[model samples]
Target: MTVTDSATTALSQGWCALSLLHGRIETHIERALQGGHDLSVREYSLLDVLSRQHSGVGGHLRMQQVAESVVLSQSATTRLVSRLEDRGLLNRYICDTDRRGIYTDVSEAGLALLAAARPTNDAALREALDEAARDPKLAPLVAAVENTHHDGRA
Candidate 1:
């Protein structure tokens, strides 16, 4: 094969590995969260994100921002919020300054559930990474994930 072909093949392989690693981690976390907290990964993620909100300026997130932070479409985020609100785990309100703007916050019950589930989520993530690292094709990706920081820095 030509050098260009080799480079393309390598890139394709890396992409596949990344996708696989993501899927594995998500599935593992999903199972753990569901089994322990009756929450899907997406639900847990939404609760966690909303739990961080505060009353200070720039501390709150709009619906669109919440959707973006949770990596969901606006409609999907709305549905998720509705589900949680129905469960008394979330509360939604219109922005005082912007009638069109809506904000969401985790309720007291949501905070309790999230606190209980945080360890399960973290454990599942670590377990998934450890398992993935055993595979030669995925070890690098696993290492890269582990070495990454919450601020998006290495």
Candidate 2:
């Protein structure tokens, strides 16, 4: 179905608002996580994904898998992994069967950091949503975001 020009305009405006809201929320969470736990949002996300994917073969995942899981480019993910490894937050190993494959697992320290950062990030998100929802026009979008999150968690 074809959308009218006005509908298209509204859609574009909605997208812009959503993008701005996303940036604000991300910034809030990034600052909170970094200030409270010395972890960047992306780093925390990588650690969280590693913890979730930990299983078998020293409880690690291939580098490619981690890259895909974190939605980061392979090079970016590699750099993050290196940083984590240097910080003793995670460890890397060569896959036994695949000579070319490298695997990574969260260290005891990484898990601990992730545990500490989770609440801080969550609280930041909640606060951001609350602030945004104060605007009547944004309440519906906030609800939609909350519902989407709630549904994802379920």
Candidate 3:
């Protein structure tokens, strides 16, 4: 095959593999949610991000930062945060330095919920990891995908 044809073939296969992986992860997250977590995958991701930021940054993250991490539009993030705030899972505060900026932090109840869900989340992750480990060739591909940052960082 010509170089161009070979490249196209490789690209197609890579896309297929990525789609399959995405579907599998979504399935795992769905299973966890249905098993009594009471939180969707996106909500869990938001909580996780807030928890990490709070622990590292001494308790607050800008709306933009959280939106980027969760792959949501700014408006969508605002709505999601509002829902979480209404549910007592998070607290939003106006930034004194920048009136236009807002910050979000996990609430105590949110932390408790996250703690309760940790075991299930860990179990799902472990299963995925185990499957990857068994497939020597797939392990590196998975790692590379995980480590990839799509935020314009080189």
Best by TM-score: 1
Candidate 1: stretches off by over 4 Å: 150-154
Arranged by TM-score with the best first, the candidates are: 1, 2, 3
Candidate 1 local lDDT, 3-94, one digit each (tens):
99999999999999999999999999999999999999999999999999999998889888999999999999999999999999999898
lDDT (CA) per prediction:
0.94, 0.86, 0.79
Better of 1 and 2 by TM-score: 1
Better of 1 and 2 by lDDT: 1
Weakest lDDT window of 10 consecutive positions for candidate 3: 145-154
lDDT of 2 by residue, 1-154 (tens): 4569889989988888788788778899999999999998899889998888645554567777788888899999999999999999998877778788777888999998899899999999999889988877677889998898889963
lDDT of 3 by residue, 1-154 (tens): 9999999999998787766666676678668865868887788889999988743444567777788989999789889988989999998777776799777888999999998887888788657755764665466667775566344454
